[model samples]
Target: MRVKVEDLYFSYPGKDVLKGINLDLKETDIVCVLGPNGSGKSTLVKCIEGLQPPQSGNIIFDGTNSSKLSRIEIARLIGYVPQSSSQLFSASVFDTVMMGRKPHYSWRCSDDDIDIVADVLEQMGLANLSMNEYNCLSGGQQQRVLIARALAQQPELLLLDEPTSALDIAHQLEVMEIIHNSVHKRGIGVLMVIHDLNLASRYADKIIMMKDGIVFACGAPEEIFTKENIEEVYGVEANIFSHEGILSVIPVRRSDAKLVPESLGIF
Candidate 1:
């Protein structure tokens, strides 16, 4: 599924967040949104998932306007995995994942629904833990379970908010690889809000940098991860390098005093 956001504007009470944001998500693209804290990256994803409505703008998904679709209708098209895994219920892993079929289920779950949920659990490597309590699993395991839930929804578009934030490096790579494979093989469009620049550069087909609720830059990872762009948007100096076909970002730390050298010198 392709998503088009035109003239998007959103604000909370007494505060303006997203400002005239426009973006296009192509099918099978792994697009990552990067920004400093409080830059509205999460808000933009929420708007795309129809969890929060844009104050003024159009969210068109595969040519259908998002506003016209009900929550369940939208869920059928886009599945969201939020940053906080703790928001999940205390249900067993199987039941938690089975909930993803709510949009397709009538009051009762059919045999087909059970088969689909089982398939997703196996695909996500959670089949062995399917009977365990969801909250008792490790952080990475829980994250994968949540993703399995989203996958069982059979959505054409997947919106993830910092999916790898709490995982270790190994788990991060594992989860990202799973997402990459799913996008390539299943043809699902992925839009994720991520904080790690190198991860974004390495995994994302395209990068969108946000600053103060506006898109600062949008392009391929190579085009958007330059030192100048990184310093300007993230307020840090980063050395961007590529090996073979992989891109990497390394941040160079600066002393707080040196960061405002001119002001310090005057003092």
Candidate 2:
């Protein structure tokens, strides 16, 4: 699916969170949103997913205005995987994944739903954990299960919020690889909020950098991941280098030179 956000405006009480935000995401594209805290990355994704509606502006999916669609209709088109959540119930992994089928089924699950869930679990490498209690899984495993549930929705677009948060390096790569494969094989458009610049540079086909509730820059990784842009958006000094078709970001320490007070918050 192709997603286009035009003049998107959102706010929280007295504060504006998204101001004139615009984006274009195409099928099979991996677009990552990068920004500091309070930059409206999460809010923007929530608005797109219909979890929260923008006060003004349009979210268009495949040339249709999202406001014309019902919440369930939108859910069917966009699958959202949130950051982290405490398991409120001890549902089995298979049952949890089956919940994604709700948007498509009104009554008991049919053979197609069962097959879809099973296929998703196998593709996500979660077949062995299907019957396990969801809460008992490790952080990485749980994250993968959440992703699997999203996949079972059969969405044309996937929205992920910090999919690698709290994961070790190996687990982070595992999750990113799953997302990468999904885009290339399933041809789904992915919009993710990622904190790690290096990870975003490595996996994202395009990067959207936001600052102070507006889009600061948006383009291919090489175009947007420059040292000047990094310092301007993130308030950090960093060296950006490429190795074997992947970019690596290394933040320069304050001890290397005299730094301002704001440098303390640099990521």
Candidate 3:
């Protein structure tokens, strides 16, 4: 699916959240949004999911304005996994995932819905926990279950907010690998907000760096993860390394000097 955000502006009474944001996501691209805390990463995803309305501008889903689509209509096209799983209603793993099929069912779930949910559970490695209480699972396990639920929805666009924040490196790789495979195999577009710069560099096809509720840069990981970009966006001086085509940053010290916009150059 092709999604476009044009001049999107959103705010609360006391503060602004998203400021004239513009983004482009094409079919099957894993786009990761990166920023420090309170940079509107979550708010931007929410606006695209239609969970929150932007004060101005528009979100175009495959050339259709998001405002024209109803809540159920948006849900049918976009599956959203919030930043915190606490916002989700807890149930047995199977039933919780089955809830994703609500958009496709009128009266009740069908055999197809059952099959889809089962397949997704297997894919997410949660088949063994199908009957387990969702709330009883560890944080990583709960995150996997939530992702399985979203996959069961069979949406064209997947919006994830820090889906791997709670997981260890192993679980993070597992979840991101699953999502990467799913995106390419199913030709789905994913917009994810992630904090780990190394993980984002390794998995995301495109990286968007935002600061102070504004997008500071957007490009491939190599272009976006330069020493200057890191110092400017994160306020840290870092040693950036590249190994086997993956870029990783080791923060050595705090950078009190702000990098001048023109002084910073991309490699």
Per-model C-alpha lDDT, please?
0.90, 0.92, 0.90
lDDT of 1 by residue, 1-267 (tens): 989999999999998999999998899899999999999999999999988989999999889899999999999998899886674458899999999999998799999999999998998899899999999999999889888999999999989999999999999999999899878878899999998888888899999999999999999998998888888887777777888887898877542336566855642
| Deviating ranges (above 4 Å) for candidate 2 | 254-267
**What pairs collide in candidate 3?**
none
Model 1: which residue pairs collide? none
- Residue pairs clashing in model 2 are none
lDDT (Cα, 0-100) at 142 in candidate 1: 87
After superposition, the stretches of candidate 1 with alpha carbons farther than 4 Å from their true spots are 87-89, 254-267
Per-residue lDDT over 1-267 for candidate 3, one digit per residue giving the tens place of the 0 to 100 score: 899999999998999988899988888899999999999999999899988889999999999999999888998999998765763566899998998999889888989999999999988889899999988899888888888888889999999999999899898998899889999888899999999998999999999999988899999999999889999998888998999989998888668644445456421
Q: Count the backbone clashes (under 3 Å) in each candidate.
A: 0, 0, 0
TM-scores of all candidate predictions against the true structure = 0.94, 0.95, 0.93
lDDT of 2 by residue, 226-258 (tens): 888988888778998899988898988533345
